[model samples]
Target: MTIIEQYGWNTVWKDKWNGKYREHEGRDLLPGRIIGDFGSKFRVITETGETWGELAGRLRHTMTDSGEYPSVGDWVLLAVQDGGEHAVIHGVLPRSSVISRKAAGNTRDEQIVASNVDTLFLVSALNDDFNVRRMERYLIMAWNSGANPVILLTKADLCQDAELKIAEMERAAPGVPVHAVSALLGDGREALLPYIRSGQTVALTGSSGCGKSTMVNWLSGRMLQLTQDVREGDSRGRHTTTHRELFVLPEGGIIVDTPGMRELQLWEDEGGLDLAFGDISSLAAGCRYSDCSHEREEGCAVLQAVAEGVLEEKRLLNYRKTQRELLYQSSKEVKQKRKSAAAAVKAGSSRSRNSGWRKEMDEY
Candidate 1:
């Protein structure tokens, strides 16, 4: 197979690259895929082979945020140097799909986990790390990213009631495939093979101790990532995979493995919440008010469903919590935009006043 084909490249991406080709004009550049990121620099795989690439100075100066930089699974335009061992990234093609999460801690920044993914495996262990609420959050992110989500419930060997856990996850994530697997025992791996076909890209993401690396190793049929044991008391494991890296599975597809996130604060839901909690959103449509808060309000279909035992109360509560978060974030973004616009207006006004004052002085 050709290099681009091996790296999950196709005509759609080729069209995007063609658009960039026109923008670059006559530059001696080639298309490369980013497989690994090293802080300010990245490791790109071009048709020629693998190479370490750094962002061009102009690209760095113009980037308004980290998202503008090349990430794992990103296809970029680059200038190969030193016999193709090193390169300079000039541009990033439009992403087909991107998986992101709010940067950890108090910051409102969005951290790009992976880009250009076709499928997202929202892996969660059947052990203590499994939380239906967290899975719901991941489903929201998966839906928002525009990739198909398949919930992977790992460590079936450890869970006595693996089927029960899978059923519970199915409830939390409606209409999405939920598979139970034991990477150690090599069970249920075949169910995932259909998603990991040639010319497609898949991403594995979840919290620590969820056996993400183990899944990677099993699927790849090699020890591509290191694994650590989880604490017996809490089942929390250290961040075995510190950085996001893309690997070519011998089986015929590409996979991006990311570090376990401690918290996945949402950046934007973009109708992801509605899809993630479609049951709640569908019921919400029957509310008396168009903007019903669904909080102890009369004629609230959502609350009525909860009361009637049709919908789980905890699920509705979590849906409300996520909705409020998205609302607050949206408001904050709008406020920021307004503030920036006001500042620009004030600055323009000040400049105009100065210009008038200078004209008057010159006239005098």
Candidate 2:
């Protein structure tokens, strides 16, 4: 296999390159995978070698949103430039999977975390940093990304009741695999090895100070990333990994380590909420009313399950909370789209009026 193949390049990608981008082959356009993203610049590994790359002028100008740009783990076609040292990315391949979240703050835009990921490792430290609710949010995004989600409870050594935490996570994330890993003691590596073998791409994500960087270093068998201690009071670690970057593991397989998120807002939900909360979804199916909201409604199976202790009330509340958040986000997106359309029409009218005025002046 070539160097690019080690980074999860396969015959499928080859077919895509030949079928769509064959015309560019004569112009020295090569297929490469993005390893590092530094805002405007990227580090890509092509068959020839690793090189710095920037988006082509046309690609940058035509991009409509941040998610369209090349991020870590994206496969892009590059044209060699500047004595073969620099490359210009001309096109991004259609992604098989993409992990994204709502842009921070009030913005209603999608921020693509990584693309073409096969598996998403949702890591949460077993210490005070562990929050099942946050894990539920991650699961929603993970299911939406079209990648298999696996929960990894890290820092098992720090927690006295690691088994209990693992059970809790299992209950919270049904149908998803959960494992407790202790990076300090180097335990639980065996359970994780199956997912990290040859040609598969896995991305680790969680809030800051959750042992994600430490897990990366351990999995790579080297200090590929820096590690830091969590604060004594809150158990929150400083942001050790500042950016998202892809690393090819020494043993085999690929991993993308991302900076810890302070808050993860939902971008959009395409049946992801139902998948993440499968138990609740199953219960809702039995409700007398097909569109039962499960709040103070007669014959609501979800409420009945919660009351009967079959389901945790807290879990149901979180599901409802996330459901409402997604609904609100959808409303905001519609309003934003309308606002943008109006602004665009107004600008076009102004430009036309200006052109007509100039023409009249010329006639004068």
Show where candidate 2 strays beyond 4 Å. 24-26, 64-66, 348-364
Q: Could you tell me which 10 consecutive residues in candidate 1 have the lowest summed lDDT?
A: 18-27
What TM-score would every model get versus the actual structure? 0.93, 0.95
- Index of the highest-TM-score prediction: 2
Worst 10 residues of 2 by lDDT: 58-67
lDDT of 2 by residue, 1-364 (tens): 8899999999889888886785574676789999998989999998888999999887785664435788899999888887769999988999999999998887677899999999999999988899999999999999999999999999898899998899999999999999999888989999988889999999999999998998999999989999988998999888898788999887688999999999999999998999999999999999999999999999999999999999999999999999999999999989988998899899999999999999999999
C-alpha local distance difference test of each model: 0.88, 0.91
Query: Any residue pairs clashing in model 2, and if so which?
Result: none
Taking all chains together, the TM-score of candidate 2 against the true structure is 0.95
